[model samples]
Target: MSAPPATSPSLVLAHPTLAERKHTWTLTQPEWGTALTLEEYLHREEYLTTVPLAKHGGVTHWILTVASAPPDQRPILSSCETLRKRALYSTTAPPGGGGVAEGIAHGVGSVFTDPAYRGKGYASRMLTMVADELKAHQGTLMSPSATAASSAADDKRLPPVAFSFLFSDIGKKFYASRGWVPHPSSHLSFTTLPSRRSSTASSDAAAAAPPPVAAIGYHELAELCTRDESLLRDRMSRLPSSLEAHQAPSSFASTPPDASRPLTYVALAPDLDTMLWHLMREDFITTRLFGTTPSVRGAVFGHPGRRVWAVWTRTYQAAPPAISANTLYILRLVVEDESAGEEYLAEGLRAVIDLAREEAAEWGTAKVLLWNPDGEVEGLMRRSGLTFEAVEREKDSILSLMWYGDGPGENVVWVAGEKYTWC
Candidate 1:
């Protein structure tokens, strides 16, 4: 008797239909729903779809399935979402108008697979298909300069997007295998409690001293973001294009040999719209959990040319079995005076951290978290006499990036790889 071998079905990846999207949510609710009931989690997902940042097709949902599967069976095997974002690309040192171009980049998030389908390679297959769609999808909004090249179809054709990023919660190797090289994954953390004094008198005296920084609210965030973007552009303009010059050499095992293409510097601008996406999400979740929104958005110190400020958001978590505790995370920390004396700069940074601690205390968070501090910030933290823990994140929130442009991927320096950049 002869036996016949069975072939596996081909997989297809595309946008999820309305029913498929909800089905995927229902599947993942047990994993990430936390304190919310299944119904409430579903409602939150619906609300997020209508946020300003997600509108106008800025956010897209994708799913993978067996090509021959019937529609009524809910064939979704894996799913994820991509967020459209504004990015800056340049190949020149000074970055003149001709060299500077504004285009779209994407933030990947909400990756999930059916628990029953584990070890079947479905997630990897889905990511491979989504990556292609991201690179070739048309109607990408770009500046006129960015779209000036001739096209076989349209009068002007924009170049493929340069890069995309995601925060990997499962560790580095998984995403790195798929082209997302892991970046810096360190953070500075401090408890919200004030430093203990030796005596009651000393504690009272310390409490009597005025706060070192000023509180910034939601209304001021947009203006601050604009200023931050200008400064970011200026700083990146002065930076060298070579990745070796920017930081330590690549240690990622999957990074390929440097290509012959020209080196380019790309940055995801910390603009108003980007900040709003994060802030809106935080406000939505925290308001629903606590019945009120957090009032202080960030802390500021110094003035004009020499100021230092930090914008932060509160993370609300249900107690116990959830491994992550409630926290106040500094989204963006700007230290304007890189050349200032150690003593002066440290003092300003200290004030900002103190304000952050106070804000964390008010919100009942356990700690304040600052991610990927620059060399200057690290130096000041060492000398400022503030007690803190500097640790590298291994398992979660590991910043990962994948390059898709024509230029050398090794040359892409992720400027301001802070918490704000996370989707």
Candidate 2:
């Protein structure tokens, strides 16, 4: 687990932790913050009505507060997404924990405080409450968006991932300015898109592994209830199906865990297995990719020599041999460490692309799109004689795609693109 923030809180609530100073900071029910049940279904819609008044437009606000003594000198104010804080934490209290899946990420919004509470540490106190909830839910992965600058040295440095927006936003500035990396939303949304081609970064040996592998495994919010009940309860804050159902991963970020129905993955030998995943991540970082994810259903390792990669065929009827029938969508691309050098990376990329190409040919799919956000990756793709077309997106991301023979129509399917919120 990550370390707790420092504030020497005199009286604050947080999840029950090993730290004695920590306590459950429930916003509603005020007393026994930890034991406090849902202020109501998701959370009190206090800010939904107020954010519009703030001129921030469509902002939602919530507060998590901890009691403090006058000696503590922390103020309490309210606003959209406002928090009323007194200190970093409170004295150890009994165990109290609960949450909902949507509340984990979707519920997060801006914060506010009262004028009287300004100078006191109440804002920090309120932040502590929201922060605690975020940790408990295990939902805080920010997709850092990349800006269109030739060099990283440009005036506006792109965040490594998207969550940086949480820190960069107006209300968050007070806390984010301290040390957090502010992210631009436009950039994050772009990188979160799926990738085009994979295999360019393969190590060759792993890429060529003889297959007939079994499915890796499938997970879902429900099935996880039986497998890891504790995680489910903690993330969603309750076991009730209504709340439990929310944690399922979205098309954009994570696939919510389900049992009878769940999102799954095909297991491959270490490097080979992760080739698709790594490639997807690579494009996500570079911001030249877009696609949806499969719903709660996934295939596990089937057998040996069976390759695992996501493709979009106009229809599911396309078999391996007839895969080339549609346009091949690349959700990920492989990348190895730099020491491997230009030659190794080139051969590795071609091998993977070739593999994808063959699979596409079987399905009757044509055209491959691959984008490298990092100039270095793009340069490598170009050096290898891969045909590509450059395109810009919303000023936050860039893309260069390779078009194969016009086998599929413009309406090709995409991997993970089916899932909406995952991105």
Candidate 3:
């Protein structure tokens, strides 16, 4: 008779180490979407140690750890590369209050376990540990990147617990079992954005929270980016625009990369190759924020994390579209905390335009081409000598500050597999 399957907890759980390469399993990120490759893991010690500090303004690390080892040899087991985006978003004011939008919101970017180690408790343990890190410090909120299904519990003002995962993932069972719940999804929609919860508030939860800050290594950020060069480019490249759209429109619940296989996988799991793409189509991973390096980020918007309303190109298939007199379009700019400054905003508007003109001149462009703003952003743009040109879309009053831009927030696309688990 065959041996029966081991219970989930039977799997071994331990800190990942380089020595465990032979026993470790893995998941590799494919070029696009969320394609993963599972194999004998290597460099098991690279977990958080090798993480590169993203230049744009966050911590980008590939989470490859040791879930468990073999039974007889107890081979040290390593797992796949699961991308984790852990940014401790902070401001002078507290978050969700009327202050300067201070505090920390830690996103798990993505988590992937090992294939050979799956079905055990490796993922759960890693996740729990990571969550603890997020929960540390005062003024910190536990907004995990859950699948759409898992996000159903908490208030939407909190980050989406579901991430882009469809209601199908139903991962809330995991977090819920641990005391967290789904946040609202309605508030996350493009339209009907809710006013940001004030950043200043006094509560026990706030008091116990860690000082929000997933500080990135600026040195590393500089190493991984191409910011200055972008000053010469045109419109920023958009994922949906560059790659093919989904055949059957789906919700963020899908949580995988787009059907087209994203060049970058915003993986939460170990194996990037296994996660389905159609799910993560709406994910912010492929946007200017998360996936692109610093150079690309700097090239898209003069500032990193400055989510633009829209962009365009004069010709050619690449991004950083050429800036030219012939090319004209209206745009929208939404600051995360408009309350932060009235004078500063005015100053910023002027600075952005002046900088743009300087770059345009360098790009051999003349005239302001065409520019327009529908809302306050229009006024801000005009401050820079820009004016609205045409209508991209029209609708009765539009929702304001729709996204937290990177516009590309981090998210999990896949897990290495049940094999990587260690309970």
Candidate 4:
């Protein structure tokens, strides 16, 4: 259906008040509450609000509604949330200047519309207003209607963000039509299967020559995440120079080098705060389901000088018939020694993946998924004797993005489109 006029008097876009917030939560529970009952889901929403990233006005809830709707009636035609996320941007040195700039990217999620309002273009109108608000904050696309809807106090508290993104569950066309172009959405999936042999003998022998994988708990991630951030910054900083040689891969800098325009690379920093937010959500669900939280946050391998590590989170679907499986996702995978030969890299990568498989089995999750594996990871799947399948996800969790304002132009490459990047 065609969206209503952008400036229609019948519709308004603004931040939801506390009551409206809870109302939207209640409205969306049946669709996204998953394994939790309504009470548990409400509590879960409360729990998430306290996380490091969600606190300090880092999250915003938005709603679209008829302006004339009565206060007694919930006027939310469509609703969604945006997370202010840390992202890195670096541009090509013009003659002799180049450095990384820290910025915020909005991670959009929990998009929902009441079933009664489905296909009425309410969501489209809501997102258009949201885009206006985001771009306005960026000091661009400041429509009078969007500006009037937001308060001056809010503008002071929240800085201009660089871009906004959402993982689309309903396929690319819908969100893409609204300016969020699709990013790479392929992932490698490994289903957990029953062990073929008795565990006693296998366990004993495995202990003797266990894979190099070592479990990393919550406390250990901060330092590593900091280090990873530095690594990511360095990679993005060098991306422009690499583009000159055509050496940078699409996963890192997908845009083709256009000499006329200075290239800019943007990447979400895989920092502790973001990782913890993902884990906090997972831990909440696991605690509700199994009465315990996962102790192994991720796995690390190799010597301290040359390490390969992976961090992951658990996804639990509503009890049976949901079609979507409960899965373990590798939120971020970092390999320190890319110069290390393919065979050596593959060995280390496979060891980490093996750890993920075992963790999935232990957690009773059906699959382990990794997004956008580079050539090296693909080599391990082919040569390491591990059974796996690659899939291009067309429906759920398709990564999508929208650049705001006069920002990084058409060639802005999104690095690190990992599971952790999702809200």
Clashes of each: 0, 112, 97, 0
TM-scores of the models, in the given order?
Answer: 0.84, 0.26, 0.30, 0.86
Give the range where candidate 3 is weakest over 10 consecutive residues by summed lDDT: 414-423
Query: On a 0 to 100 scale, what is the lDDT of residue 241 in model 4?
Result: 40
Better of 3 and 4 by TM-score: 4
Best-to-worst ranking by TM-score: 4, 1, 3, 2
Tens-place lDDT per residue, model 2, 69-140, is 231232224222321110110111225522321111222333444443455555565554554433322221
lDDT of 4 at 57: 59
TM-score of 4: 0.86
**Cα RMSD (Å) per model?**
6.3, 22.4, 19.8, 4.7
Q: What TM-score number comes out for model 1?
A: 0.84
Across residues 1-423, which tens digit of lDDT does each residue of candidate 1 receive? 111111244677656666677788898888877667788788877777767666555677777776555553646777898887778776563436325556677789999988766666778887877777777543322222221222222644545566788889999899988878777688899888553222335647766564557788888888888889888877766765544454534322235436443456667888877777777888877767777777778888888678889999877666323425888889999877778778888888888888788777766678899987876688797798788998888889887877787655555656677788878
Q: What would you estimate as the lDDT of candidate 1?
A: 0.72
Ten-residue region with minimum lDDT total, candidate 2: 83-92
Model 1 clash pairs are: none
Error of 2 at 124 (Å): 21
Cα deviation of 100 in candidate 1 (Å)?
Answer: 4.3
Question: Mind giving the per-residue lDDT tens digits that candidate 4 earns over 1-423?
Answer: 333443576788766665677778998888888888999998898778778787665677778876665543536778888877877887554666778877778888998887877877788888988877776442222121332233333545444567888899999789888888777677888876443233536657655465667888998899889889988887777665444554434542223335555556677889999999999999998887778998988889887647889999988885434425788999999987678677777788877888788788777688899887766667666787777888878898888778763444455667776788888
* lDDT (Cα, tens digit) per residue for candidate 3, span 282-353: 112223213422111111222344322111111111123332322211111224334544555555554433
Best by lDDT: 4
